[model samples]
Target: MKFFSKRELIILTLLFVLSFVPVVGGAIRILEIAGGPSVAPDNPRISNDPFPALLHLLGAIPFCILGAFQFMPSLRRYAPKWHRLNGRIVAFSGIVAAISGLWMTNYYALSIEIQGDLLYVVRMVLGTAMVLFIVRGVAAIRGRKISQHHASMTRAYAIGQGAATQTLMGLIWIALLREEPTGLMRDIMMTSAWVINLTLAEWIIRKTNNLSVSGSVS
Candidate 1:
């Protein structure tokens, strides 16, 4: 632990917390599917379809949780081979998650009245963009463009994390506003979720590279 610089320690802590969100969500979904109570399937707009939700949960576990550890500098430093191995796992599973999200946006907009079309459109655009970013990351790694690979993958992962952020934001909206969001208010908040997450991801990506360039552990 003493060997880790402050920045590295902070990043490690962040990764651990970030990994918790989706993995726990995934576990809960799996339990829900196994006949544990879940409010998810009761959504009228989603057509009560459990298929996409199932796929999304399964994909999310590996993409969000396992993917987070790929950012650990210690792992990369001491286990380069393991890093490369799990990098492949992260990339592939992320694609599955991205595609399932897009499928839900395009064909599973069952919560149209509650979620609104704008949120659907937001998911469509962001979901497709996430897939492209994942593909770009893979290509960058294949070409041995390490920096671009990292940046692209960082963007992909952050975009995926929007699901977690949106849940938190939704809770805040309900608590502070003292009511559930609807219409334009809901649309604005949902759109902001992805936009904010991606923007922050870009900043962190650049910061990590800058630190790496300056001979600091990123």
Candidate 2:
């Protein structure tokens, strides 16, 4: 499909706009809570964590930049290079986010409103998977297997960049269903968002004739 086509452009624009709102909202919430300019989560440990804070800051930048590139024709031509670089950035930053997020989840556990243990496990798993996916994607690219590399990188990027979709769906499902929503909202949001993104990415990867030669050989 033509991503630059009118309808695709509109959809992509909508998603990008949706992504912006939560970051702003979270920043405002942080300021209100701390009387400071920050995007700290409601966890004391996290508020005090310099390492994780740095990671989150770095991670968010690449996510926004690379995500924007997905829509820009000029930048799309540099896909292979950007894909590899973004994968490394996201993988490293994801590790920091997950580790720091675990502390926050523990704090939530103490509050008794959320199941911190479950969320912690899920976060750890997702983080590990994301890192592995990126590394493997890099390996595929290095081996000159563009198809596998593209598919794997796309999957990794989708999940890594899922912060917006995860948050939105988590809130939307909670608001509409009034149910606890199976699994943590973050996990569901991340997984569901990635599923959609990877599905579309897969189609594009195939169309670009970037699939691994090994697959085509068989």
Candidate 3:
């Protein structure tokens, strides 16, 4: 079980590391006074100034990377103060990411549905859930409910990592589907980004509790 936890952390680390490229790319675009291939030109998000894209990427970099380390047994055991400090950062960054995401969703024009059905409703629901989970997790910690905190944060982190998973799943969809998804199929494939990550996170939480079953999380 310990081995499994370690493996899971390693995987999360890889995903978090992989997230840097796009995050940095988006950041650079945000800096540009106006001269870069618009990742989503028509989508009011990138077109606007300080919006949905820039803020989300800014929040995502710290949130994804910092949250990834929280499960490291060594760090938790030897430097708990650091973990707590970093957790505070992660919590705030997570909220930022969620809010920015919702902002994008509210205004992101679904110009095309070929990639996947990333509908407005989907974004609203998921974004709201992410924020709530983070709040609940923080509350749990304040109340000394470490297990509950672990579960809630796990859910929040799982949702946040959707950014990374979507990239990977997008590749898989392109490779396997051979044909782009549209309509309901597109929606399911798009939403699968979060669903897949959350599924794994749930498994990790179960494995963690099984291994330690202690006040401190794995």
Q: What are the root-mean-square deviations of the candidates from the true structure over C-alphas?
A: 2.7, 5.7, 4.1
Model 3 agreement with the true structure over 46-102: per-residue lDDT tens digits: 565455676787788888888888767666777789989999999999999899888
Q: Write the per-residue lDDT of candidate 2 for residues 2-96, one digit (tens) a residue.
A: 43657556756776675675556544554545566655446654455544444454555455444444434333444547644655665565555
In lDDT terms, how accurate is model 1? 0.80
* CA displacement after TM-score superposition, residue 170 of candidate 3 (Å): 0.9
lDDT of 1 at 170: 82
Candidate 3, run of 10 with poorest lDDT: 110-119
Candidate 2, which segments miss by more than 4 Å at Cα? 1-8, 25-42, 68-74, 78-112, 174-218
* Model 2, residue pairs in steric clash: 147-210, 147-211, 147-212
* Top candidate, metric TM-score: 1
Best by lDDT: 1
Clashing pairs in 1: 45-110, 45-111, 46-110, 46-111
Name the TM-score of candidate 3: 0.81
* TM-score to true structure, per model: 0.85, 0.62, 0.81
Q: Looking at model 1, report the run of 10 residues with the lowest lDDT sum.
A: 39-48
Q: Write the per-residue lDDT of candidate 1 for residues 45-134, one digit (tens) a residue.
A: 333787787788788788877787777777788778999999998888888898988887777655544557788788888889899999
